[model samples]
Target: MKEQIRCAVLGLGRLGYWHAENLATRVKGATLVYVADPFEKQAEKVARELNIGKSTKNPNEVFEDPTIDAVIIATPTSTHAEMIQLAAKHKKHIFVEKPLTHDLQEAVQVIQTIKENNIFCQVGFMRRFDSAYMEAHNRIQAGDIGTPLYFKGVSRDPGSPPAEFIKNSGGIFLDMSIHDYDISRYLLGSEVTSISAHGNILFHSFMEPYHDVDQAIAYLTFDSGAAADIEASRNAFYGYDIRGEVIGSEGSIQIGSLRHHDIQILTKSGSTHDIVPAFPERFKNAYLNEIEHYIDCLRNNEKPSVDEMDGKIALEIALSAKKSFETGRKVLLSNPTLSLD
Candidate 1:
């Protein structure tokens, strides 16, 4: 019989709970032993519901436990670097949610900590695990699409988050479009050379105080001569719509659909179908796939497909985009003066 990787999940918010549920029940070769969050009741409730062995209000306990082999840090973006550094100090393998840190210096420090500890660290860019996106990537790699030339991506949330979240979310690029940035690099197989970005507080006035926006867009020029346009919005009253397309010299590959099912009702007045209402529902399988992959990598002593370096690069691109938006100029990734803080 194969050994199981004992695990713990920190944070019990929406995404955190989902990851904990997957680690508890779905992921093979994984045993969820502990759960932690600042809210004692929330942590205890999640532990009880998931049948985890222990629950704690302090995350330090999770890092201190020698029995745990890995931890999924689903805590707030602001706390990622500290949690990651602590976990690395404990020599525990880590799976952290996206955008390692809003600040590039902190990202660099987190990368250094991971390297110094020689621990396996995987970032949660789950789009790479999605079936359609994976197919597109495979086709691009197989040369079925020849040399990619252009990319277009759309990401929309059904509604805006509270003002508090926006204030610390590092704005739209880091909180939302960072996914698009990561997937663009993954599918285009190139580094972003420069980016021009623009944003506005179209509907969410609450975002204005934070200098954040409800709608944003960016144009990316890649080293491979491929260009990309990404649009992100929190006012997708229609639904949680996400779609992407890549045009290559030979042909083009398209990914995603607005509809949840193939069938749509036809009527004299109109036609309608179910739409993806939220990210968790849309990327459920990808979330599970990422955790399973993390466990598999741990058991096999293999490196994760998406590592801290990828996280760092993605954060750099996101910061570049934000800087471009703020200054109303195209920002080069090579520019050394860039800083989010």
Candidate 2:
């Protein structure tokens, strides 16, 4: 029998922890070999619980360890490009979370490095791995949604991140709306040609200085003549919600909501509680399915369904939207550039 691939996880935050725990306990043909975090206690705790081979505060330990075959980066968005470059230099396959990099130049460099190294690199656009979304994609490709015309994607969170996080989040367009950007591109099957956006800082007063718009809407014109509308909100008040619809020449398909029952009517003192909470719940299966696909891709030596180009294009759309929101004018995506802080 072949030996297990050695894997390590960087960053021990919420999403990082989840990736570490899941890869350690659930994935087959992979051994959880190391856990790295700047916080020593968090790394040690997770490593102890999972019986991982090593835990360290310095990420260099994991990067330098030749025995470690792959690394999962759940670090902050600002650190993605550097980590990717480092891991590529070490010839380690990498799994990085979304919005590949805060800057397009860095993104381009990382892609070039990964290609030069001839190492597998997968960005976390987990939604593409979703069964429902994949089903929709297959149908669209199979001509079920003949010649797509328009796509709409909505993503709303229950609340905003802490003020400190908001400052560094690259505003809502890069942090949250990027998901919708990716989905829109996936459904449209074409490159975005131009983008226009409008946004407001309605919910959080603290976000004003950072220009962190909490509510945003963007329009994307695709190269194939299809268009898409993406809506995003950091505060939903009630629940997390994400849904999409693809309208084509022949017909349309909509992804169902989270609720088991589509229709519910209640009459009690003229009050009703009908809508289900947002996407974290609605796309639970998608999260698991995405990770499983990553594992399978690694095991089979297959390229990821969502590659660096997909991540770059999504980031391009998101940055364009931000530019449009700021300038109150349409932004062309032909020559995409971003300012990294």
State the C-alpha lDDT per candidate.
0.92, 0.83
The TM-score leader among the candidates is 1
Residue-wise C-alpha lDDT for candidate 1, range 1-341, written one tens digit per residue:
34899999998898899999999989989999999999999999999898989999999998888998899999899999999999999999999998788788998888888989999999999999999999999999999989999999999999998887787789999999999999998999988999999999889887776889899999999887899999999999989999999999999999999997778998999988999889988999999999999999999999999988888889999999999999999998763223323
- Model 2, TM vs. native: 0.92
Candidate 2 Cα outliers beyond 4 Å, as residue runs: 1-3, 258-280, 335-341
lDDT of 1 at 261: 75
Worst 10 residues of 1 by lDDT: 332-341
Each model's backbone clash number: 0, 3
lDDT of 2 by residue, 46-149 (tens): 99998887999999999999998889898999899999999999998888988899988898899899999988888888788777688888999999978999
Residue 36 displacement (Å), model 1: 0.1
Q: How does residue 294 of candidate 1 score in lDDT? A: 95
Stretches > 4 Å off in candidate 1 = 335-341
TM-score on alpha carbons, each prediction: 0.97, 0.92
